[model samples]
Target: MNGKKFVESHFHKYLTEHLNAEIALNTIQNFDIAMNWIRSTFFYVRAVRNPSSKYELQPRMDKDLIDRKIEEMCLRQIKELQKNGLVILNGMNLQTTVYGKLMSKYYLSFETMKLFRQIKGSETYLETINTIVKCKEFSDFVIRANEKGILNQLNGSPIRFPIRGRIRSNEDKISCLIQAVFGNLTLPTPALIQESIKIIRIGDRLSKCLLEYLRLRQSNDSKFRCYKALLNALTIVKCFHAKLWENSEFASKQIRKIGAVHSSLLVNAGKTTIKSISETDARTIESILNLSAPFGNELLLNIMITYPTYLLDISLKSENVIQVHLKQLNEEYIYIGSHTVLIVGDSLNNLLLYEENV
Candidate 1:
């Protein structure tokens, strides 16, 4: 079938299933309810899809009937929002609630918003990642015929989280791919690597959305679960950027000039990843990577110097500012963010840490 017919048939089947289930049409009480409402769009879809003269649609609706249908659809959706606590219908005007605002800020779909609303902000880090994969954004990722083998291969290799049973649905693919990214598992092909990276970038954004949601949840209840979820969200956010788990010895592989082999070798020899290279002598790391005498020092210096030397100001008569302010000890840089950093300018400048705040 053509694209239009295919979409029509898809919706027809969807509506039929909803009808067979005897699902209510008034309010979307949860994610499943919201999804059903989303899928049950046959009536309006047909009305809109049949404008072409070639198509013969159902009996034409008069102006009054069309307006009534429009009103009914709008009211049904509004009721769904009310049921989900996303909006408040006071008299005539419908006002958005905090949940609604949060959903709007993230540009989340109604279905996704419902799912987010249900989360209590107490899930484990792995659970949080799994929850994020359920977003509507990942629904379109088609798992190839042979991709499941690769996913299972990644799971068996060294992923932070592994799945059991058959890998079903795109959500599973996303979750597996994310774990593969964190573990730095060698994807079979570059295409697969690129695909995983794209998913990672999108997943990173959704993870941020969940982080904010958890933070809000914590503020309201102040429960241990809420605080834990917030903390997990924070860690998950950083992991997404670093592309490695916090405990992964090979997390340093994300740095420039560092690879899985380099990290593995260094980690095995009892050296540092990226964080505490300062504690280890440069010569030790150098010898492990098998570089000549001074190159190890140079490698160490290059990597350490770029670890968040803030661009306070870059000065010039051309009105450029300059002053490298070392902010509080954190992986994030004031200018070039992320643990993996490259100081573009001042290749000649040396980085020194001050014991006291400057």
Candidate 2:
């Protein structure tokens, strides 16, 4: 099947099985109640885990994006547990067990399966999930795994089918198992090799997925290509946010400030993807922009990609003053407009583009 169908089929099957199992296990008299509870739980966990969209830069808020992010987040956590030879199922904490529940339907360790009950009424469920999905710990794990050929080793094992592997050493069986999931490690093309190194340095699951997706492509579909382009745009914006956040407290604290920086960066990525759009999609976007948007169509897409759910309002309440409302963080405002407006710039020379009257 096609890429979209592939993702949708797997996701639908997974969701159906999960919801039915929840109803049966809970003995909930009402199927509607069980379905509502299960969906709310998914949304709650998602909101916390993907908080980057709420601050700094806009995260991809699409269901596909959320699903991919959380899956990888949990997967990286599993890889970390495996690499350390920690009994993947041995953890009993509220947060760690979310990983267990998330993968219980799959072939994870038995101990991990046993921990799913810990999440049933846990008070820290949301906080635990937040920490799991947002934590940077997995990035380091991935880097070490890359260096050790641990992923390659696990994929080649006879115990694991379809997926392949190779190993630098048999020092850790769990590491080998982790490699099994990726199948055989083909030599990455020179382009992919460069992409891998860049993504590794960015050190986030999203970037890791982007690199992997690029390496695993065979589709010629335009929709798939656009979807892939959107991923690349997000990777670029996220990496930009990450690097700036690492080096400066201001960038971390000031959401709108960093946003303007990434907005400028996304304009370039947006320009390329704009050409790939169908005329219908293009017109729909144009119609939406015709209603009081400050930026042109391309820049608006940059903003949408950069900050998916944010509200940006332009207020010219005063002749000498302009107000840009970046609604997610109410305390933040960015200044940019017109010719020769005075600019306050960041250390990286990310111009906080605020322009008033000439």
Candidate 3:
């Protein structure tokens, strides 16, 4: 609208038509080259015209045209990924590098991964959030004409981290939605609710991606200062899973079933985290939150097992360098920072920093 020609809603509408199409469509994007997803897409688009015969070839089975489109999509995607260092030409064959492998293995888009590569492990907390909200994953988080006022009202309320400036941009909405998830803020609309849920679902994954990128950066650069940024990333991951800001006064909500309303009750009753709940008798918590007997312990158990534990190993690769690894350990629990949430199965969520000043 502002001289960009197609407003964001235009692109979002097109994406919705492709992704949520009722019939075969060739206008979708990002072909999965090795999986032959492109071939299937092309074949499906062509076959939609002749659905009467399942096995019979279509009236216009232009194999050459389909082949050409597939080839072009493959080369175009691979070139973009390669240009951004996600893909590499190893000898005569094009293959995924470690970065590329992680991105693929984690279901990350190359567009988001490319944005993630810009982080230098020296960003402020706000800077990290700013960069992440702009990733391709949040590109679909469009700001409607009406919702701006709602978002503006929420920004004025006691949000955990009050953002500067007016409420605008898809990134701004995403930024607000993420905080709403963390703060368990009461959203007024289903759209806001669904958006919060989507962001929550991907929050942990994004954290993993960030940590993976940090690990890679630490490995290659001996002088990288990773302690603060790593710790902040870890806290962000914890906040995502815990569904509460790191510095929120209502920390008791981290306990399962103790939502925003009852969270304050627990705090007033001197029960904050699971550790606090563990210390108190079940009857005490029940009396505090007005739940029936034994429900408190049940809630505690849910909190304990609500999220799966990942084991993360942070070992020193050298005097000034640290390598992060997702190892299968007998012990329990870990944490990130990334576009796709550099996640590992029972991995991420740990960091150890060592420096040689003398």
For each candidate in turn, the TM-score is 0.67, 0.19, 0.65
lDDT of 1 by residue, 94-118 (tens): 5556666666566666666677777
Candidate 3 has its poorest 10 consecutive residues by lDDT at: 7-16
Candidate with best TM-score: 1
Instruction: Compose the digit string of candidate 3's lDDT tens values, residues 1-358.
Output: 3555421122211221222221122222333323254345544454433322332333555656545544554455556666767655444245445676566555665566777787766677777766667777776679999999999888887776677888878878888888876766789999889888888777668876876777776676666656556656766767776677877767777554667788878778777555566667778878888889679778766655543333667787898676765533322432121122232211232234422110
How many pairs of residues collide in each model?
8, 20, 16
- Order of quality (lDDT): 1, 3, 2
lDDT of 2 by residue, 234-319 (tens): 33334333433222322312232224334233333342222222122534444433423333455434433443233567777797
Candidate 1 stretches with Cα past 4 Å from truth are 1-59, 221-225, 283-287, 290-299, 302-358
> All candidates' lDDT scores?
0.62, 0.34, 0.61
**Winner by lDDT:** 1
Better of 1 and 3 by TM-score: 1
Preferred candidate (lDDT higher): 2 or 3: 3
| TM value for model 2 | 0.19
